[model samples]
Target: MDVLVLIGRVLFVVLFATSAVNHLTRSKAMAGYTASRGIPFATAAVLASGVVLGAGAVSVAVGLWADLGALLLAAFCFSAAVLMHGFWAEKDPQAKMAEQSHFFKDLALGGAALVIFAFFAYAGHDLGLMVTGPALSLG
Candidate 1:
């Protein structure tokens, strides 16, 4: 179980690290791409996303506040997948494939984030606060 958790964390870190590097290095292209997706303040958005991605990756890799890192990374990925990669624009085969791939990847990442969150919550880790009661309230 430890090995599996470590592997999952490493994978998430690697994925986000690569994305962060891309966003940081290719700011103009990323900004343009984001703008094309109807996101306002594309440049600022890319920069902010890059910061979150990089920070999340580092935190997860170091096993420091990993749950929160996973949550933030999941949010970034979900937003990018849904807002940037709209399914309606499937005219280009390549674009369609990329968009679909990102969408599924983000979905998987979100699941991973949930798993991490559950682990931290159950282990009594200081991961923010549960405002609505127990983390896993069945009722």
Candidate 2:
């Protein structure tokens, strides 16, 4: 079970980790797309988002401060869904469908991250964890 949980954690972070790499390595292209979405300081935003993603990936993978990591991921996902994948802004039907799909995907990812945050931060469970941090403790 521990091993399975560990695998799950790693799997969950793979997309974020890889996307972070892309954001860092392909900043110019990514920035151009981000700029098209009307994001201010697109390059800086891309780089900063990459950093956030990297940090979140590491934190979640190691189960250290995972709640914080999950929160960061959730924020990134939700923001990207709204700011980057705005399907309603698309003029072409195909583009709108693609954007709508991406928008939903981001929303789902954000929702999953929030679930992770709640599980670790509020449930007070340490099963299958290497190390834990001060939980978010919203209550």
Candidate 3:
């Protein structure tokens, strides 16, 4: 049971951490794409999203105030889903499908984050409110 939880945590963190590295390393490209999508302050938004993603994923991986971490991720995911994907705005079926896929992916991540927050706040987990251990633990 503990091993499973630990593995899940690692897998979850990997997604966000890798994405953060991408955003930080490819800020210019991401920002340009974001601008193309009509999001204001595209560069800043991309940079900020990367920071939040990394920080939130790290916080959850270590079970350090995971509620806050989850909120960060939830915000980032939902916001990105709306601003970046916007599947409803697409007219072409193929394009809409692709955008919808991305949108749902983000929503799924956000949903997971919400569940994590709920687990800490209401699932009677002692270590969820604070930092319990390193990233490999099953807090």
Find the candidate with the highest TM-score and give its number: 2
**Model 3 agreement with the true structure over 40-119: per-residue lDDT tens digits:** 99999889989999989887777776667777888899999999999999999999999999999999999998887676
How would you encode candidate 2's per-residue C-alpha lDDT over 1-139 as one tens digit per residue? 7787779889999999999999999999999999999999999999999999998898888988888999999999999999999999899999999999999999999999998888768653656565885357753
Model 3: residues >4 Å from true position, as ranges? 124-139
- Residues 20-126, candidate 1: write the lDDT tens digits: 99988898898998998899999999989999999878767666666577677878878877898786677998889888887888888877776765675465233
Candidates' C-alpha lDDT: 0.74, 0.89, 0.80
Instruction: Pick out the ten consecutive residues of candidate 2 with the lowest summed lDDT.
Output: 122-131
- True lDDT of residue 95, candidate 3: 92
- Give per-model CA RMSD: 5.3, 1.5, 4.3
Model 1 accuracy (lDDT, Cα)? 0.74
The candidate that wins on lDDT is 2
Error of 2 at 59 (Å): 0.7
> Which segments of model 2 are wrong by more than 4 Å?
none
TM-score head-to-head 1 vs 3, winner? 3
